[model samples]
Target chain A: MAHIQLPEGLPGIRGAMAFRPATARPLNDLVEILLHAPNSLTPAERELIATYVSSENDCYYCQTIHGAVAAASLNGDEALVKQVKHDFHNAAISEKLKTLLVIAGKVQRGGKHVTTEDVTAALAQGATDIEIHDTVLIAAAFCMFNRYVDGLATIQPRDEAMYRERGKWIARDGYVNVSKEYLPAEVAR
Target chain B: MPHIKLPEGFAGISSGFVYRPETAKPMRELAHVLLHEPSTLTPAERELIATYVSTQNDCYFCQTSHASAAAAHLANDWGLVEQVKHNYERAPVSEKLKALLTIAGKVQQGGKHVTSEDVAKAREQGATDLEIHDTVLIAAAFCMFNRYVDGLATWQPEDPEMYAKMGQHLATEGYLAPSIKA
Candidate 1:
């Protein structure tokens, strides 16, 4: 049972977001810009950062959905997604992404846990100032997103196939389109 | 020194936001809507939620500033704000607020930590669905806001009086107006 009276059939943040479009629009807009907006960081890399942070937070729904999205963006490399979640340090990824993942992990632990050394290392590994900034923002945002989904006890689908299908749509269509398509009629209020 | 070369004389999240106004615009707008806009939950109660979460995160700047804002709204009851921070259960507040704070505290720890019993407790205390929802958002959002401030290692003011004065302005001016005023 959902803690709050959310609409039927909507799961995770989608349900909660539909319940309150007033707050949802801005929150969704933020995600759209963070993940889908043009930047030096590839969409795949950004999704990986989100996936890694969601995994660290132990948010089952977010981790699964975003993991699938990251995998789809990386040419259907679902194993890489699992590897990154289990242990990105040992995963087959670029050195730069590895360093960014380190920073993202620290942000998940606590803000103060992110030290000057982390930034220095990322810089040494060729991460731009903007990439570092975005990584922290992504991690920080997911903390909020993960908590929002789980804090409300939103329903989460358990099937891997479901996440993969959603991930494919999100990768091709982006968040704005997916949100509009999936949003229920009454909840749009 | 901020990690990003934020403009001098700006401290904490302010400097960081100013550094990247593009991201800051929507964020500040969201805070304005969430904290200042009229709702079932009064601005004071909402500020208390922000302060509570910031305290949990141990972000000195956020806790101090928001504590002052909450105090100013509560007719300068600084001690009450401090009590909430030290121990909300012992503090003199509504049963509903106590239950909500319990939920907020759980959110600060981790989302999974919140249980069905916690929600039932809040609802039993007469917390509406919107109130419970907002409480969770406030707690969750503060996690982001706190991390934004502390993650960048921004400078924080040391004087409690400074926070008190800012709180006064914020109480009267509201978040959107005060953010522009200060």
Candidate 2:
């Protein structure tokens, strides 16, 4: 049961979002900008960053949702997503992304945990300042998002198929479009 | 010297935003919406939520700045602000607010740490659904903001008065107004 009276059947953050649409608009807008917008980082890579942090935070809903989106963006490579989550250092990703993940990991633990050496390593590996900045923001934002979903104890689907289906929709339409379709009547107001 | 070379004189997160004005636009807009917009929760109460979370994160710049801002909103009652930061349970605030602070404190720690009982407690104390919702958002956003500032190791002022002064300006002018002009 959710901490509040969320609508039935919608999983995870979606339910909580429908319960209060007023706050949902900006939150969804931020996610759209961070994950779907045109940038140096590919949408897959950005979703991977969010997935990685969600994994570290042990947020099941976030990790699954973002992991599925990332996989969809990367040619339906769910195995790659799982591998990266299990251990990105050994995963078959570029030196640049791996180094960026290092910074993201440190941010997950605590912001102060990210060292000057970490930034230097990423820069040396061809990670631009903008990429680095986005990685930190993605990591930081997921921390908040994770807490929001789990804090409310919203219902979360465990079936992998649900994630894949949802991922396809989100990947096809992007966050804003899907969010608009799902906004509860009161929240739409 | 920050992780990135931020503009001089601007303290904490402000300096970091100046370093990358591009990201600052949406971030400032979010703060403006969350903190400055008219709402049932008084600006002071909202600032108190920000201050409490920052203190929990132990971000000196945020805790002090928002603490002063919160105090300014409450007629310069610095003592009251300090009390809320130190121990909201013992602080002289409404029973409803105290219950809400308990929820905010749990959010500062981690979201999953908050239980259904916590929500129930807040409801019992006369908090509306919207108040509870905003409190969670405030706490969650500050976690990101505090980490953003501390992650970069920005310059934080040690002077207590400086924070109080900034707080006064923010309280009087609101986050968007002063942030825009600054």
Which candidate's DockQ is highest?
1
Best by lDDT: 1
Which pairs clash in the backbone of model 1?
none
lDDT of 1 by residue, A12-127 (tens): 88888877776776686678788888888999899999999999999999999999889989999999999999999999999999999998899898888888888888889899
Lowest-scoring 10 consecutive residues by lDDT in candidate 2 chain A? Answer: A180-189
DockQ of 1: 0.73
Query: What is the C-alpha local distance difference test score of each model?
Result: 0.85, 0.83
Kept native contacts, fraction for each prediction: 0.60, 0.53
Candidate number of the best TM-score: 1
TM-score of chain B of each: 0.94, 0.93
| Model 2, span A2-112: residue lDDT tens | 777778888999887887676687788778888998898999989999999999888899999999999999999999999889899999899999998999898877788
- For all predictions, the C-alpha RMSD in Å is 2.1, 2.3
lDDT of 2 at A122: 90
